[model samples]
Target: MSDASFLSFLDDPGFLAAFVEVSRPRAHGAGLDPYDYDRVTAPLASAHDWPAACAAAGQRYAEAAGRAAAEGRGVTAGEAYRTAARWYHVAGWLPHPDREAAARTAADADEAMRRALAHLDPAAERVEGDGFAGWLRRPSGGPAASRPVVLVVPGMDSGKEEFHTVVEALLARGSAVLAIDGPGQGVLTAGSAPEPDYHRVVGRAIDALADRDGLDPDRIAVVGLSLGGYYAATAAAHEPRVRAAALVSGPYRLAWDELPPFVRATLVQRCGGSEAARAFAARLDMTALVPALTVPVLVVEGGEDVIPGVTNATPLAAEAPAAELLLVPHGNHLLGTALPDWLPTAADWLTGHLTAQR
Candidate 1:
């Protein structure tokens, strides 16, 4: 609960791994299960092998995704979906350029999406925005052009690919979707952008979505995974155009004071050692900055979360003028796979707000 306790937890490598394992069910349920779950479970697990496993998983996922796209399944095919999930898992476990490698895996995912779209009606387009950018996926069937729109944001370590399942699910529900690589995420991190000032980066994403063709604009909803939740909440508050918002396995308060030690250690490890990790940590002040959002908001939390405790969601719900909280009993930090059950709830809530625009 306190900052010290959180930091202490982050310092222990064993504890971090254990917490991750415990969080697996949630991630698995959410469709983001990593490939190393079984391999990493061996006693005395070798950290060195983690990268190799991640790379292999990424390659496999790329191939599978391509196959799925060719089959008109949009990354939902058993092989492609599993591969994408493995990429998320592997990326989390892999090292530096490995993170970059994970992004590359995401690029393959983009290709898969493109391939799938090609099979559809080809309403997709590569759009350029102010601070951020992405490809917009619109429905292809007919001119029944009144579909709801969703703006999907990736997590801290995730890229646009991670939301492949989410996009498919929303699209199936007759909604147009836009998935983007926000700052410090995907292409932005690989490119010149630094860790973005949340407001500026997400505001630009909203700006981009609002201007797209055939989009209801008024029926736009925002969904953020992991750290994207913070950005989504902030954007929903400041940008009135976002009718509703959902925080998927994301925390409410920034927890500048209380990040679990395992998380800190993981960051340190991700940055390639302890010193760099500390330096990176110093740059972040996790305190929740958004006061109160008027938009209809859905806050999803993991019951056994190690990174951001379940308690974090409480304050966020309190901060939102109209908010609903869904606690996944066995969930972790990843909520994408849990879409089957959660998406409907999300769609229902969003429909109430977005459809009322008439």
Candidate 2:
């Protein structure tokens, strides 16, 4: 047998290259400062070392958060816990060979986020369902009984814990935010397969949040990034309860055969096999599906976010009759490089639509 045949996919040159390259922008976009990303990853030389290296950093911050909390330094504790959570969250992305251990690591990330929110926003609530989990929070000092709601959905290989900035942005604009991780995402990945009919997952989220006090059920909006963007668009088209949406770096279509091996492998891991991954990939295309969406939509595209085998959101924006497009030339897939230009604008767009006197 060839030595190559026995090697873990983590060691494959292409997998290593793509994981390392993609990790930075995704980390930064998710809340890690770029400088911290460099420093944390500098000593790492291989994908196999990635989880341990990141977890070590996460442990350090987690300890710091603990100490800060014990000292009654609430702000410091909050910041430390958030940083710790981000590290652990980053650590959980790889589809490791030790599936049980990988799942434990995911749980650690999930727990850290809960602690972070306890310190950061005491009002934050954890919401869960059959195939999803989320942190639901309202605007600071929001008015009683009808604050517009926004569902902040994360992408494939992303979780509810990562989009802190997006959640905060939406909260700042008077929207109650639910940052969610659905099937094949966040902590749920260990148990659930990816659902290409993501609208169902979202429908369940809406049902969970529907009767909550101080959140307007009829005024719900969605802001999703990457694969989550596709999910949000899917829900907007089919779930009539979704009043508005913002898509960030979502694919307009996906061709299974053309996808990068890392992406395909991730899907394979989540979808159960190569054939299932192929089937799910085919379901991701929105070339014809998005045109029927009637709610106000904002599609945010990173001009530089060219991924193999994926069609970007530009065409979705152009085709959806109610869509408005925001293109950022220097942004990476998640706009980690150009946040200021797109984040607020999109948040404003969503809140405006949700709060409009409709």
Candidate 3:
């Protein structure tokens, strides 16, 4: 017999597949370490209480963060809080309909992350728009306080919280960075369904950034990861204010019918339901859209990414007038395995292009 809790939902193959998809620390976000992943999922291996196990794992990390903070080890404390946030995010997921408990945990995770970010150099300043929120960071001791900015959008299941590493990477290269949660993403909606008109979402972000003090309004670059690639491309096509655009593992043409059930389910809630979701995804085709791209663009793909298919980069390169395509031979989705390769390349590309504009 099964209980009427979130654990019952974990038994579903789709849920398990979803969990396994992001189980890799290297290939996924920087929030969770390998040890945290194993610790959180270990209880699920048996028939024991899975949620409790997740809580225990999160608590362990929180305690570790406390200890690190007490010792004045800021970096250690930050990393520990990052892991705890991921655990709390997992703990918030449920098999049943009620999401209150999970949302509360996710809020806790966000606070932990904010605290962690405070201890790091090039510290993040929280920013908000009418419908979304984000964190802004700049390079430490850079030539000028005001610098070019890269606007980053996370994947379908992720939000600005998952952008910790990317923000640091951009700052290291002397570029200010802004990572945001669009209408249906993190902090904004408590994990609610997302809208399809991501261009509008991005436009609002740009508008907000335009008034911000320490960023060059005319030198803003946009980068999207995973499903966010689609959002970035669309935003660039319509938002003339964006100086350069980059799509990493984004789909030029969406195949809503072919998407896995887990992906569809996650999207449905964001889009309202299956009917509305399909209609929303169907509008995501960037085929004709890329041709309208008037600014420099970069499309990077992984040879091993079967989900969105690696070949999606081909048409994007051919259509966009100033597009450059980079295909990593053994890279996985998002080039997560090839971070050392792609992250620097993207940063260099943005830096080079934006510098030329200045």
Residues 95-132, model 3: lDDT tens digits: 22344554566566677778777776435788777666
Candidate 2 regions exceeding 4 Å error are 1-9, 12-18
Worst 10 residues of 2 by lDDT: 1-10
Tens digits of per-residue lDDT, candidate 1, 65-106, equal 667767778535545544544454444433343456645654
lDDT of 3: 0.71
Indicate which candidate wins on TM-score: 2
Candidate 1 vs candidate 3: the lDDT winner is 3
Q: CA lDDT of 46 in candidate 3?
A: 34
Q: In model 2, what lDDT does residue 259 have?
A: 80
User: For model 2, how does the per-residue alpha-carbon lDDT over 153-250 read when each residue is reduced to its tens digit?
Assistant: 88878888789989888888888888888998888878888887888888898899866788778898888889988988988998888999899999
lDDT: which is higher, 1 or 2? 2
Each candidate structure's count of clashing pairs:
12, 0, 4
Report, for every candidate in turn, its global Cα lDDT versus the true structure. 0.59, 0.83, 0.71
> What shift in Å separates residue 71 of candidate 2 from its native position after superposition?
1.6
Model 3 pairs whose backbones collide: 6-95, 193-269, 193-270, 194-270
Poorest 10 consecutive residues by lDDT, candidate 1 = 1-10
What's the candidate order when arranged by decreasing TM-score? 2, 3, 1
